[model samples]
Target chain A: MSDEAIKKENLSEEVNIREAGGGGWLYSDVVKDHFFNPRNFMRYGEEEKFEFNAMGRVGSPACGDEMVLWLKIEPETEKIKECRWRTFGCGSAIASTSVLSEMITEKDGMKIEDALKIKPQDIIARLGGLPDRKIHCSVLGDKALQAAINDYFRKTGKHERVLTAGAKVIDSVLNITDKDIEEAVLEGAKTIEDLQKKLKIGALGKDSLPAAEELLKFYLEKYFKS
Target chain B: MLPKPKKIREIYFDHAATAYTDERVVKAMLPYYSKTYGNPSSLHRAGREANAAVNDSRRKIAQILHALPENIIFVGGGTASDNLAIYGMARAHEQRGKHIITIPIEHHAILHPLEDLEKQGWKITKVKVNEEGFVSPEEIYKSIRPDTVLISVMYTNNEIGVIEPIADIGRVILKYRKEHNTPYPYFHTDACQAAGYLSLDVEKLHVDFLTLNGSKIYGPKGIGALYIRRGIKIKPMILGGGQERNLNAGTENVPGIVGLAKALEIAQNEKEKENKKMRKLSLYLWKKIQEKIQNIKLNGPEIGDDRLSSNLNITFMDIEGESLLLYLDEYGIMCSTGSACTSESLEPSHVLRALGMPYEYAHGSLRFSLGRRNTKQDVDYLMKYLPVIVEQLREMSPVRMEKQKHARYK
Candidate 1:
């Protein structure tokens, strides 16, 4: 928020702009464009060869907003590849993933470690800047990358498991439970919109992994065991 | 590079959180900050003079509330006042009963402490509010129990502009005592939001223990008065210099106390005129925004509502309040989303949520509170700048850009 945007021209007519989302000098044409209509966001189906897979998953059962990020890296070389992400966040979080994917795609064979070092400000800087309050949003982006990297190692078995199985990360990422959603939905929900609207998405199933319904059913049946 | 006008270009509308220190209050505190910089407890002449200043301020505040000078205690701020009232009274009177009743909409100043008490083995019954965020006296009456030792409610809501019926609710508690054999509930109110707008006669409101903060009422911060109503006995919350008749302890804030008194005097003096003016301005802004902006929802009561006159909460659909706040800040237009505490959370507002404001509207709501300093011109300028920013941001918004465009064309 620039100090200048809120000039009170007069009392009888203070411009009551809808208090909206994250912004700053980081809010430039690039950020706006990404936020307005993010490019390269949709997945191209399983046919697109994925080289690098980074998914940051964060959730909190209490606060009630769980966010997950899935990034598909199309590696042109041993280190470099293309990246695309699907995220569940406000416009900034989605725009962040799209912008981050775009930024990582620019460099070829880039080490994943360096890609991880990419600050949220660097991403916001790409746009123009984010507001002071929204700067926290930038941190959430970095967190998503960290979580995705951990997930990458988990799938590849390249590093020791950073997260305990089924344990929740407090702030960095939310652990979405297929079981929780299924039960909440099965309790009364009739449609996808009804399910999503009634409950927060704790987790989404990976395209390569078992379906969400299957995983939830498995958990439900296990819990229902005599 | 331009010379200043006869008046500044400052347009202040964020009075709900706190008001800028008034010039008169500043003048009243100058001597205490510099010349009279002596601890009220010291034996020296400077100290005694400082002590005199503290007593004078305390006396003035007590006069305003129609309380005895000895009964008033100067505390840190409203939060401490509320905590002391609820926790202090409950702790001493635990033998009286273990049950307590309070509304859900109280500023955490009172609610949080009660919540803490529940953890410490007290039976707590929380009353609910209606869609307007107003807690009903009927609900309070129904929720009261045999063991209930205290009943706490806020005089005015902090986030939304709903005014609680303190008098009516007080009557209910009074009725409960007359009908049943329950000792009267030590009625407490966090009046942090109502000091400048409503008429606060403790006798009429019938609050046993009331909390008020000077900072929120256009005086200095860290200074507020807690009215303990002559005979209400409670254990002290703070312990030190044993100041404030041992009800509160610490060296008296001589300067802050003086400023608080002067500020309260001015606020009480100007309440009617200022309230009337703010009533007109809030109506003006609310009407104009409804007409000019499309898909916008008003969060609190209508303009003619008996609630706080300075408050105007509006929801711009398909937008997030945080982003809109940033854009408004860019234009030097300051406002708030929810309470100051909710700024960090992605959740919109507890008050709005309690009022049944949906996610779509709550997420995009903005709080534009008016004050004595604001004039019609300031609001008019806001009307001019606000639409452009909304149009621009809405154009860039993924959720509502298309819809906003359609509405704009229509």
Candidate 2:
């Protein structure tokens, strides 16, 4: 949400803070439109209707957000034939992923590479904008799409493409692994600072920091059984 | 040819947040704002009229609370009254004692000030409430110290609506004061939520100070009163002109004061009948929701005099609260949630946490506070859609998936 959107929503008397999911003018009009009426949402018990070639799942419902994206790819054009998603999150998360789904499979379809290239900023632009706190929600949509594209590549025996793309790569200098992240978390490295202090995370590149943080959270969630 | 239909009438269940200003109250205030507008400090006829209105409101509220008119000091809403009572009393009596005692379930208005005092080298002790959301007077008594200068507890909790044993706690405070021959520890109760449904006779409750707000009782916002027992001294929070007997220093809010008095009068007059009707509606809605929905848990005490007649907080398992709130909003129903996502701080209700509720339940809790305007028909409308909303959100929950996975392993 921009300053102008905030001012506009505040100026409007009809916007109920409770009705906006307690976001209180934190969402853009576009975001609200997509959230209240999400396009290509995989409704409950309807996943069986779509024969998708790839599936991606991320986040945990216990932490109050999760997304599952299923994509059907056209083999002839190597484009996404359809994209549908199921999400359990706030309005921003729903809207970001909703627009992402629509953007990817609109008209004929977006190519696999083009869909993978779509970033959180692209989703935010399409949805007008999200609040600063809700920018994290936009990241979920892009991450899920990456996972879906990875799934598609692996399923089609395109092993080289799968390996070359956004697969979780081990940090060259820190040598951070899923197991290493789990061990650090169990050894009381629960925060990003703790990871950096104990395991020297980001010793190699800043790109590995997000991956380490993600794995740390994943393992922490598992450790706490949440 | 047929015409399209209009939308259903919206139902508001967030009365605990703030009620619609009564039309009667508004009518009474209009003259003060336009015709009788005057600074009470001015020595003109208009000023006299405004001062008379303020005095009349003070007398009206004092009579309702069974307190002397002179002891009623008007200020800005509940938060202001709370600040005046806690910060004023604590600062005034700090020389006698630097310790304060309160419950963990108190509103932030009380809790946050005590915390600030603690930072300034005051000892603060917090008594915990039980899982049923009741604070035992004995627990507060146990926490009381010789240096404890104030004990501020809310009369009725705004979120859970559990009525604390305030009079009993007051008796304990009075007994301790009498035995010690010291007025070091003064008892206060924030009765903003209780002003409508509960008796607030200061003498009967044995409280040194009591806080009441107008907005929660269909009165105008930005006006409230604190009942200060005669002969009790407290420092003023605001410093300026000698208004509000020098306790609250500002030009009087004549319109708001008049509106508050009228609103309180109407609330007191109709409290009994309103409570009876609302209690029945609340219980009916509770039973209907329980019967219609699975995995539902009530968050507050059992419905009765002990609980506010209008408050019903419940949690739905396997679903988050924000989603339920949004869905209900689309259906023209308004309510609040205890979920962290719903709050600016991203922290769930401290009252629920004090009750020892699990994180999942705390994250899923929804608060429905009924009011004088609500009816069984409105509740019927709620029930018609709530079950479906809960079911849809539950189906989308990942917790359900985890449960299925666990069952498969079994």
Candidate 3:
């Protein structure tokens, strides 16, 4: 056989094994598309070129991921004219942020309130679905968007209109809040056992057990269909 | 400017993950599967033929390691060999002590088993590694105790490809044994990665137990052997028939044994030439990457005698490793990463973390392990797309710190 034919045969054999063993492309085609051709990403050294009134950043470098978002808003209309972001995260994080940018700025712009209402589930759904371990990445985009909107509100002297994303305490004794439960759900807490393993939500006081369990179920239903 | 990037065949650069089976080894194994297929335990002509194949294979491997054939025990795979050596030796020597000395940069196959041993009342002292992922013999010597039962250190790290000072560490153990007038603490080295490139002379290394994997050396998967020193008692982990001198009990894998022996012979014979070629290619790959990509930190030892010739791990600042890996996969260039997102447990590589690498740098790490099939053309092809991919990912990344800031951590 020719060298090229032998190479093709070998390639097919390896590819077959990889696909059969679930080592092929990890994400959906949508996720791959968004990751490869991310929209509205602030190119390196081009932060100054984009006109933006408000900026927000989230995640810590120590946590292995961080995201910074830049937003240009139409003041009179209270609409986001442009959304650009940069993320130091995995493919899911990049895809989520890319799709979020498109969601907010597609067909001109989205109202600031509407953009804030776009949940992590929406971003994940638009990308087909992220891996269970990677669902936390989608939430980062949502939180960063809220952070930017709050920044816009603070800058515009609309202090009362500014919203706190996760301040409602769900477990009073442990100071664990609904946000903690929501995050646990996004991080693959499918059952109460998984939730307890992650957060130890009601370990301190029995009083918050029912509440924590209730919130866990609510977040589970909100994120996962089950 | 550049001609439209031509569609290239897949470049298998993840040899450190696993290697393609060599045709010669397969050819050697074919006859054992069909013609000489028999239970080695059975008293028949076919059984005797199968048994002879196993013995001959063991002899070939023993010759390479400069060990006796009777000392080698065939096991399932690399992890099985490690598990057997650790649990078997530890269980047998429990009366001596429960203490074990190891380094933090060992593969999960070793570390996880050690963790299990720790839960079973065994004391494990993990010696720290230097910034370049080197565990000093002095530190290991200091960690050794009267109660220390085993010293398990890998011959070469699978991730960063850092070659440990196993012989020096072995000599330290030997000196301790001599001074204490006791053979309580036995030394073991997992030479799965080193079998293809380095020496496996058990006497020169002064190791009591050495692990070798078949798949890592272009042999069949699901086959490995552990070389135990003569007269060093180790309890069998698997219990059934009287096989492998009653140290391991299972149906003998005649084909796998033959293939492993054949692959090891070929690897040993071609070791020097292949190492020279890979060393030159790896150094060239690193140089080209440095020239093309900015703010990239080379993980582990410099590409020389201290590091495996086929391995090159780099941390491209600002971009997450999983994202970079995926982009490279698009170009049909296969590699692996130590990034948290790529790992199932969502924790960054324990090996990189043990090296005191910051979380961001650890998440950005990528390992490109070259192999026999790789050439300068593969490296050139990688260079053609790697810079563009890194630039794109960096543009999308939010962490915009100067490399000098992270250099302090290094």
Say which candidate scores most in lDDT: 3
Q: What is the lDDT of residue A191 in candidate 3?
A: 74
Q: What's the number of clashes in each of the models?
A: 58, 2, 0
Between the candidate structures 1 and 2, which one is better when assessed by lDDT?
2
For model 3, residues B303-404, the per-residue Cα lDDT tens digits are: 889999999999988888998998888788999999888776677899899988887788899998999999899999989989988887877887876767
Q: Model 2 segments beyond 4 Å from truth?
A: A1-26, A47-54, A73-79, A137-139, A149-226, B1-6, B401-410
By summed lDDT, the worst window of 10 consecutive residues in model 2 chain B runs over: B401-410
Off by over 4 Å in 1: A1-98, A101-226, B1-10, B339-342, B400-410
Worst 10 residues of 1 chain B by lDDT: B1-10
- The order by descending lDDT is 3, 2, 1
TM-score of every candidate's chain A: 0.51, 0.65, 0.70
Question: What DockQ values do the models have?
Answer: 0.06, 0.22, 0.53
**lDDT over C-alpha atoms for residue B288 of model 1:** 83
In candidate 1 the C-alpha lDDT for residue A111 amounts to 60
Report how far residue B201 has shifted in candidate 3, in Å: 0.5
Standalone chain B TM-score for every prediction: 0.92, 0.95, 0.98
lDDT of 3 by residue, A1-47 (tens): 23234333322122221232224567776777888888888976687
What are the per-residue Cα lDDT tens digits for candidate 2 across B1-410? 11122565699999999999999999999999889999998999999989999999989999999989999999999999998998898878877889888888889989888889889999988888887689889888888888888888889999999999999999988888788898758889999999878888888888889998989999999999899999989999999999999999999999999998999999988889988888998999999998998767787788887899989999887677887898788778999998756765455688887887755567788999999889888998888788887776665444554334323111
